[model samples]
Target: MDATQPELKRALGLLSLTLYGLGTIIGAGIYVLVGAVADRSGMSAPLAFLLAGVLAAFTGLSYAELGQRLPEAAGAAAYAREGFKSHWMGRIAGFLTLAVAMVAAASVARGGAGYLLTMIDIPLPIASGGVIVLFTVLACWGVKESVYAAGAMTVIEVGGLLAVIVIGGPALADLGVRLPDIWPADLNGWGGVMGGAFLAFFAFAGFENIVNMAEETQDVGRTLPRAVVLSIIISAVLYMLVILIAVLSVAPDLLAQSDAPLCLVVDCEKSTMAFFAPVALIATLNGVLIEIVLMARVAYGMARRGWLPKLLSDVHAGRRTPLKATLAVGAIVFALTSFVEFQVLAKATSAMLLLVFLVVNLALIRLKQVDPAPHLAFRVPNWAPVAGAFSSILLLGAEVLA
Candidate 1:
């Protein structure tokens, strides 16, 4: 290792990394997207989530294999460079990953502001701008601190979702919604479910961001793969449960109409679940924080490798964090939040990640063929990357056509 090269502190253990992954995975997506998916899939929203989870897992397995082989920040870009041996390809993949982070953070912040307005009377711009600034400072403060804070926020947000489940469970029996309705009927119904799954795919987007924190995590090879898979499974279960409760508690058409859909699930008649709104606000902020942390690491990794400006590689001597990259990411996120609407930004985020996932899966397949590591800590089946690449392309097409 070069002594002059900027280095991030390896302060994150397995627990912190797993919690961080869980926090990122269960963040703004479930809080904000359940209603939209319900609109498309009707009573079968849980099926959409389940199918989306399967799609996410396929690509996730590829990432798990790559993480073991090359545990580094700017994960997808690093994989592309090693697999394809093309600087331009690596650069594009890296920047695209960063773009996804920025757009996702901005979308979450915008949604957070909407949640905030339900409790307080403030301008959306002011609220959203305040979220970006606050999270940026937290991100620059220290890696461990930022992740721990996010973990706490994750607990609160998860509790909120659980509360909805418990509250809505009894209603399911009363509504007489048959269990079979959770699955769509025929080819036409399956098409609608698949479209909903494509939209629901956004809910599973944050798991890949975990790989970008490779440099900061303890025991990267041993820990990253486990954390990635565990976080996705946990988030998938929670999303399916929440979606089930949502469809059971309210009419799909009505759930689709509101910005804060979870609140409707908690109390559709009053629509004033005091705890749900604040919890959602926390979830959105947590999403922004995690995205900021991931983007900074990506920028730092790219800069350290000369793919980006060297200045961005600078680590704060005292904090041992990438302050420059953090601020740069913050600026971009703020600009996006200020200019773009939530749905547009969300779709852009999903679309960009689908492309990145395709490249990453292809990279993994290429690496397996050209540079087989017999002693990798983790390895997926030969067909895993192929399936991952195929699913990514299929989902990308579905998203575009939808």
Candidate 2:
């Protein structure tokens, strides 16, 4: 191990960190999974999102508190190591965190490719594979550069969602008339709502990604926790409104049918599709970029901690990024995006994240017991982790049973 390895540069401020948080959290899930969620939950898709938001909130608090405490690169792994007093558990957590990034990126890449096909005539493998390559190069460029790119794309994606709300204005007017259509009519309908929430859980996956950026964030104890909470809250509100408009403007059945569901929100006309396909493509691309960055950082961090190979921790002195780790993570995702279909990848992602969330929540619980009153750490009430753990179990069990 090189004792004098260069550290990650701390160049991120509150706004940049917050935008990165939003970009990651809001990326893949809302753009791709919304239709899959609406298909099952029907008019009640908004409620399913709301429920998922609440579940994510409890876990988000756990993350925020832990970030304030550890603020390390492989965040969940650090939390596990500190809380459990075991190096192996930390390694397990680190690899699981890496897996989450890979699987999430794969699914996002696949979903983005579907939208890209609508505007350009290209083979599916080429579209998805090209995105992974382009973004991975951007990630290795530098932290500030990658984030600036991600932040710009985040603004455009947020604007795209607001546009959907405006375009679907007439549907909001009839939301009252549509209210009766939303509630579950029977056991089958309720089952769909439950199943839909499980899928929507994948939509809320990005909040935890912010914690991994802690090593590069200035004043991480203060900045990262705030970013985690703010991003989750803002994303939840946007997700509900957009899904509401989507279900109301078009039949859930029709939404379920299209690859680019949001384009179909305003009727999927040529002009609308022209505007939206690009925006949707940008949103998905931003997600892939962020996750690529995340996996590299985690690999570097784990290597630094001796959980992964020492080679991964070697930073590019000129670029000041994890060059080797970035390439390794990107190559894996480039291959993965071309394999599994989007929904299967999404479900697998959701299940894995739920388990990670479950373990993370438990970690916080154990950490609180070990150091009950750490000074200046962001503190959540004791019930937060408890609720987080139980809710994770509930969702995981529902997914298994259904």
Candidate 3:
């Protein structure tokens, strides 16, 4: 950028961005979807999460290579443009990213409102919209401010997960007996696990969001790739342990029934309700905030590349943020949250994300073919994106047939 132009401040380092990465994947994804996955796979819930994690890793590696190869705010869009050699493809990718981010944020907000209503009576629209408005203000204030809030919230949420593990830890003693149930030996059992993996895949959606922050991150090539890989590995490990504990502590059917699955793990019967309410709220809010920040950067990136209105490309002088873009994205998120049901939003968001991943992985494959010169800081195996693309297609097909 020219000296006169305001650019995104590169204030994020490894720790902050990695925490942000954790926040993106861990919050609403695991918080809400765990039980649903259990509902599908029963005792084999951990396997479903493991399957999802493996698939995500393939795409995550593709993203790491892409992020290092081209560290831009546009992220997938930039990769699409370079790979397809068409400006039009970049615009398509940008809009797809915006749509997925908004829907994902809305779903998380709607889910958060459910948690809020249990604590106190309020209209769903008001509860959800209020959260969106609050976070939009935070995102526009500054990236550092937003990341700090997110990092603190991430720690709190992680603590909540640790609490669940502790409460359910003893359940593992039954592992010797439960081992047989946890593995699927027959076609019927394996089918259930595959179905669960389809839903579990959605929880892995947020790692790609890390790439959108490339412009605002320090040492883009090194930090972005490492953060992507670290977040996926860490989130994957935590997910398996938590899901295993959850399925063991409670019947898969029982855990499946709860809106707050982790709370069920706490075995809370004494208090007002699930003792985990406060932490769940913060986790949900952190997710929505990350989504809003991601969508704004996508809008700003697209605008800067002449795909959207130039006004969206404009940055706030004092805050060094894409103010108008943030406000616009937040408004869209609120509207969707107010109107759409959580299930519909989740399904749509997951489908769009998979479709985008398919395209992005393909973009990486093509780029790899034409631009083979090594990026020494980061590079995935030649077969990585190929597998990523195939897995995406396989999952999409599986979901459709089911």
Candidate 4:
């Protein structure tokens, strides 16, 4: 049987697409990157996040362009296939993209378990593995159910962060604006701020996941670019605000020391709100898990298209989920979880994602020149793709340098 003939449903709307994008982008970075960013950027953590967001915006535009032209699942892989006309290269691009995604999910899973363990004094590995398995099971049930769960979780995730902002507003105001000492005499110099930008960019990484949903999203030609651009901007702004609050509410040094910086800052001022830590952790986990599920689906889609090994293309007849690909990815995530630390996992994911983004921008530029689909539902000015391609190349260089 021709694999593509076994059609999957396309039931997602613009709102569902946006929620998935938002949820995936907003996770672990806010929970996990605060201290890492604070330590690297000093008082300039928000600035770093802002810069990273700007960099990510360029690539986001590139994705918007290709998503319209290809408008299929396995977003980057599809783009690569069309852009380069090489199935082998497309497979490599798609595989690395999905690999980083699984690595990210496992990293967050372990981190969530650590938070759970610390919160309740349970064994870390066992708790983390259990959570990962449960999330994978949920993903294998069906995309329809996953979309609803993802949308609901995104709301709670956003609310949890907002709750922190509201509860910490007074504390932040009391502290006044504590800028990271940019001057050499005060703290980390300019070099450190750039380094922090590298770290902060991770928070904005999920926008690419939007590309993978092109096959399932409603009105792909019109909605994908706008959704991609808007989601990237919205999530970046929220990250900036949250980091800014954390930076100002507590001393930078103190904020950098804890694993849970936002909660620690909140706890410092109003210990009564300590109950929200696990809530935040759950929010982050849900977001990461959703993205991983999306990644696995993308992998399965690619395999079905013959871009990957046939083994990964199989869908369970009963559930119609990409059970084979899901298990393969889960196994890789578990292996990496055992061996790697969060910093390594995050940076590696960033590096792999940067490569995919580079290709996406290139594909957009090439597609514009070769195909020139002026009637695309989402059209950027012709020059935007050029600029987006150039900027993405530069950032990819920087990602490598970092």
Candidate 5:
């Protein structure tokens, strides 16, 4: 924590936190993972999404405990610093969290740009930059405005997914419901499934984002944990439902080939709802907007605490937003988008995310022993945190083994 800087305002309510969680959840994962999982699991792509959700839930419990204890910006960093009792561990955790944010912004920016091109005749790069610029400006404006925009975007994105479900409901009903062989009985056979799990982890990226709002949230101890766990559950269910309808409504092989799987679903089983593609695309664009703002805020928070360049700590006087940080984050994301291979970017995201979650879990265990917080708005059962931490470690090992 920067002793010199003024304390960040806590303006986020539970609803805002929920929106932040949801906005973070509905990003490139939904746009990209459907095909990747379909390819890996054949017809059981929905199961891959569910498996990823379960893995994320364990991490979520760990986060709920620590997020309640720490309720500070640089969420993972606070936990790591307090838990490990080491400055370096905190620094590494914060760095990895920022790394995930950068890649997330890049992926969402690229996805938003693609959506814009599909809706219009604009050049892809130019449209992508436009999306980045829009988000950068919003983030530089302030947290309150960004939260409002994020909340609205969450609704629109959820509406898009709901549209898909409503349209595909009849088809889903027609196909007898049964759990497929998604979670292989061998469990050891997940050697092949790890890649898809890594891909699906993208959906859970937004949960850590709540820590960025520590400065802006009201009653950080009470609300942060609620937001963390509830938002993850909400987003997970929504994502699973979207995947279920999307995979079952069409041939899994065909979905594996389609680039815009939801759009393809709409074009096929729900042609009447085809008009909503534009709406869904717009919602995705809004999600990118929220992501860019969050990326900037987290970077700003880290910098204020001396984790990054001090220059990033600058805030616009009128807007009270981290203008310099917003610009810097946008530039970094844009450069990555322009130069790096997407697959490498995605894998890097997965690896960094795993580390961040592991640190958060450790933070909870550490704080429980060192600085026990009481009467938190939320608390995980004692064993849940331990189980969650080990689960994260195992999943990370699996990812590495793959």
Candidate 6:
């Protein structure tokens, strides 16, 4: 092994890093998974989302604490390694993080293709495959360039969601439309809400992606935690508003039926909200770009730590980017998109992420007890990590049992 390790450029500031986190958190899940959540939780979808946000907050705090302690790429894996004192455990956590990103990218690619079909007539494979290739090149170009592109798309997507809220504002004002029962009285009432929360949890999955870019962020110990927390808070607010408006604007059954749920929020005849299809396309592609960037960084970080083959750590001389790792991630994403259906890919991604969160929260708790950081810029209450770990385990159990 070479004595010296390659390093990623530290060019991202708080704004850029926060934007990256927002882009990642708001991407694929809201664009595609909202309808799926509606299907599971019916009128109670908003409540389910609220529960998911609370659950995510617990884990998010844990990540923020760990980010201050060990601001590294492959964040989850690094946490596991430091906490457990096992290189093998770190490798496993790192690979799981990579798997979640790849699966999620593929899932979003498939959903993006569906939205593309609504805008223009094209074969599904072509639409999905084209995005995978395009975003792969963008991700490989440079970190700053890729993140800038993602930030712009994030604005457009957020605008799209806001448009839905604005268009549905009148509908929300009308008290005649019956709101969904907050708590279902049916036999499967609580069970269904839990199932919905499990799905909604996937929407909040991308905040952790921020920590994986710690190596590429300026003042990571301070900047990363803020970005992680702020991004989650912002996304949670937007998600709740969108879900509430969606349930009120359109019937739950109708919302669940459409591939493009938000587009259906406005009156098709009265409003020219057809532009939303393109917005959805941008949102999903942005997600693909962010995930590809994250996967590459995880590979680069692991290889630098000698957990992966050293070749993956190779950087472009001029670009100073992880070119080899980027290409590797792109290839895997392309293959996954080609074969996997969106629903299966999404469930797999969510399940894997929940497991990763479970392990990550546990790592934080163990590290606090066994190898406390000497100088953490930010600290969480001692009970925070403990609650984070137990909540994550409970959520993971719910997913498995369901």
Instruction: Please tell me which predicted candidate would have the highest TM-score against the true structure.
Output: 2
Per-residue CA lDDT of model 4 for 87-189, tens digit only, reads: 8768877887887688778667655553465477776666666766777778878777887787788888788788778866775554343333432334335
> How well does candidate 3 score on lDDT at residue 22?
93
TM-score of 6: 0.96
Candidate 6 residue-wise lDDT, 239-339, digit = tens = 98888888877788887887877777765434476778888889888898999999999998899898888899888877878899999999999898888
Put down candidate 3 lDDT per residue, 1-402, tens digits, no spaces. 335768899999989999999998888778888878888899998898999899989999999889888888898889899989989888888889999999999988876664566577878888788889999999999999998898899998888788777777898888899899999989888888888888888788899999989989998888998999999988888888788888888888877787767777775554743657788878877899999999999999988898989889889999999999999999999888889877678778878898889889999999989987574588899999999999889888888977
lDDT of each: 0.85, 0.88, 0.86, 0.73, 0.73, 0.85
Any runs in candidate 3 off by more than 4 Å, and if so which?
1-3, 271-275
Q: Which of the two, 1 or 4, has more TM-score?
A: 1
Residue 329 of model 4, lDDT score = 73
Cα lDDT tens digits for candidate 5, 123-228: 6667667777777778777788888888887788788778777877776664465444444555554554665767788767788777678778887877888888
Compute the lDDT of residue 383 as modeled in candidate 6.
84
Q: How accurate locally is residue 195 in candidate 4, as Cα lDDT from 0 to 100?
A: 76
Could you give me the TM-score of model 2 versus the true structure? Answer: 0.97
Error of 3 at 149 (Å): 0.8
- 176, model 2: CA deviation in Å? 2.0
Off by over 4 Å in 1: 172-177, 268-273
Clash pairs, model 4 backbone: 43-180
lDDT of model 3 at residue 43?
A: 93
C-alpha RMSD of each candidate structure in angstroms: 1.9, 1.3, 1.7, 2.7, 2.5, 1.8
Q: lDDT at 358 for candidate 5?
A: 76
Query: Residue 91, candidate 6: how far off, in angstroms?
Result: 1.4
Candidate 2 Cα outliers beyond 4 Å, as residue runs: none
